[model samples]
Target: MKKVLFSAALFFTACAVSAQESVVKEAKSAKSDPVKAAQIIEPALTDPSTANDPETWKLAGDFQKSIYDDENMKLYLPGGQADTAKLYNSLAKMFEYYTKCDEVEQAKVQSGELKKPKLRKKLAKTLATVRPQLTNAGSDAYNAGNYANALKFFGLYVDAPQNPLFADEDAVKNDTLTPLIANYAALAANSLKDNAAVIKYATIGKEHKEEGYRSLMCLAEAYGKGETPDSAKWLTTIQEGVEKFPSQEYFIGNLMDYYIQKGKIDEGLAQMDAVLAKNSTPYFMYVKGVLQYEKKDYEGAIATFNQIIAEGKDFVAEAYSKIGDCSFFPAQEIVEENSKLSMDDPKYATNEAKIKELYEKALPFYEKAKEAKPDNRQLWGQYLLNIYWKLDKEKYNALEKELGY
Candidate 1:
């Protein structure tokens, strides 16, 4: 029985030695036939003695990564697709194998089995070359309409340690590509409707110095769409975007709509007032006018609109339009009051005169707006028809004919 057991142990040892030698030979020749090479070496990754062997891990990693590198070459061969999914899978495996190699190498160094600084530096150099490849894969996936896969690739590129292409893990600042990657990842998550991932990446991306406002917008959108929507967080993000990118009406406009929908016009006005106090830019001035108009502070709106005109801003037409809108409200009020009274009532004539005066006051601003924005003929025609009805019936009839009314 003892002799049989010894023979079995010898047989097993010989088989292990043969397997190791095959793996080494495969690794050496993998460049020419990487698929067959990988098939031979992958089992060693889980084998007890080889699993912790740095050389085994390194060989597997280098061989698989070479396979991944050659994938694009296959597309030039006859009857071959790029097979991006397969390429991405190979890259994923490469990263895993490289990471395992790193772990084993570090363990070997700690155990005094290897002297390491040189080996670690070489591994870092290898990782640096691989980093941008992952980013390229992400962009390719995104262009191919594979957003989830794009997210996976970008996430790996940005999160990998010692990537050299991105900023440190503590923050992704200073690196332009870092924000770009985060933006792409966030957009991918948005396309997938993965609200949580959108919030995650977008929130981080919002710290980007040059393009943070875009990320803030994404975060706001994500918050509204996420499960159990957080309106407060959404509002805060929108406000931040408005403050950071005051010239960008997209954020301000979204905030305005949010306030209007929630019946918080006064709150919106207060927020705009704060923004106006800080910068008083032409855009913010225009926003202040809009907010005041929504709050029915017509006189304040007209004054703010005038300030935009004084600044010689491009929003002059819009300002004139708002000023005309201010006069419209008072004119409407006079007409409404007059409608409640009989024509013979003593105050009826007085109200009619007041209404005509207000309409006349509004008409010039509307005409100026029309001159500034001639393409807005429909808006001008509507306002002119109202003014002509209050003052000149002949002109009203002629204008109505020209307007196809």
Candidate 2:
């Protein structure tokens, strides 16, 4: 009876060994059929009895990664191409498995249970190659207007710490592509109107030397678009951007607008003054003139604008127009207040004389502005006609005929 029991146990043990052998053989033979191989090894990867086996994890990784092979990817992935969103999940899964394989193998190597010189090198190559795949996926998603997925893919590339190629220096030093990736992510987030995401990604790019200026602008714009934006934060970002990117008119212009919006024209003037004190650039001087105009300092604005014209800068036309505007404002204020007054009043002649004097001051600047920028004839044409009507009806009628007014 004992022998009979032993025979039965032996038969069962043999059957179990044959079944394990069959599975291993099938796993190896199904290399071209990664789907089949994956099915064979998945159980071993999860089974507690074999879960700790590094070889099982490595097999799982290999099978998953094989799904991205040039031929296999086209056949198995969506879009029937290597560079489609359909391959994103597959590529992501490959990265995950390979990371696990590397981790388990490295642990075994540390414990003196494995020797993986060739495998470690291979894993490094694979991780580096995965980076471009992620980038391609991101580009594909971006071109498709899948901004959320574009951001996700780019973020994955930027934050992928499991990559052996980046494992050493990624934590301590910034990657050369890090800023560009963050910038792209910010662009994607911005397209989606994800203000928070724009702030987050652009902040990363803002620290980079090459992309910092663009990132700062993006961040500032994002802050301005926020539901409950912090004006101080927006102001700070624009100021910083202007300081760092002095050549970028967008930042300086944005900074000026912020001050104007806050009713701090004096502060804007002081800021422009400080910038001019360092380097009296034509643009800066022009901006100072604008701030003066906003402050209703017509004389100061005219003086500053004259200085801009003297600089022989490209903005001379704009300066001339702004100077004309400065002269017009006071006369406009007087007309608005006293237009209702009867000509019989004693004050009428005095007011008319004052208005004429102001129009005279504006006339030459408007004429020069038109001469300098004939392409913008329409810009100051109405003002010119109005001034002419007040002081010279003949010129007004001529200009009205020319402008079809």
Q: What TM-score, computed on C-alpha atoms, does each candidate reach? A: 0.69, 0.72
Q: Residue 12 of candidate 1: its Cα lDDT?
A: 99
Local distance difference test scores for all models: 0.78, 0.77
User: lDDT by residue for model 1 over 1-405, one digit each (tens)?
Assistant: 999999999999889977876766665776578777888887777776678777787788777777777885786789877777777778877777776777777777778888862345565556656667788888888999998889888877656644432223333333357766777788888888888888877876777777777678778878887778898998888888887877677887888888877879898888888777776777778877888898888888999899888888668888998898888778888889988999999999999888888898899888888888878775477887889987899989997897788
RMSD of each: 6.8, 7.7
Error of 1 at 140 (Å): 4.7
Give the candidate number with the greatest TM-score: 2
Model 2 stretches with alpha carbons more than 4 Å out: 1-30, 33-64, 67-93, 96-125, 132-149, 161-173, 278-280, 392-405
lDDT of 2 by residue, 244-272 (tens): 77777788788898788789998888778
For model 2, what is the error of residue 355's alpha carbon versus the real structure, in angstroms, after optimal superposition?
1.1
Model 2, poorest ten-residue lDDT window?
165-174
lDDT of 1: 0.78
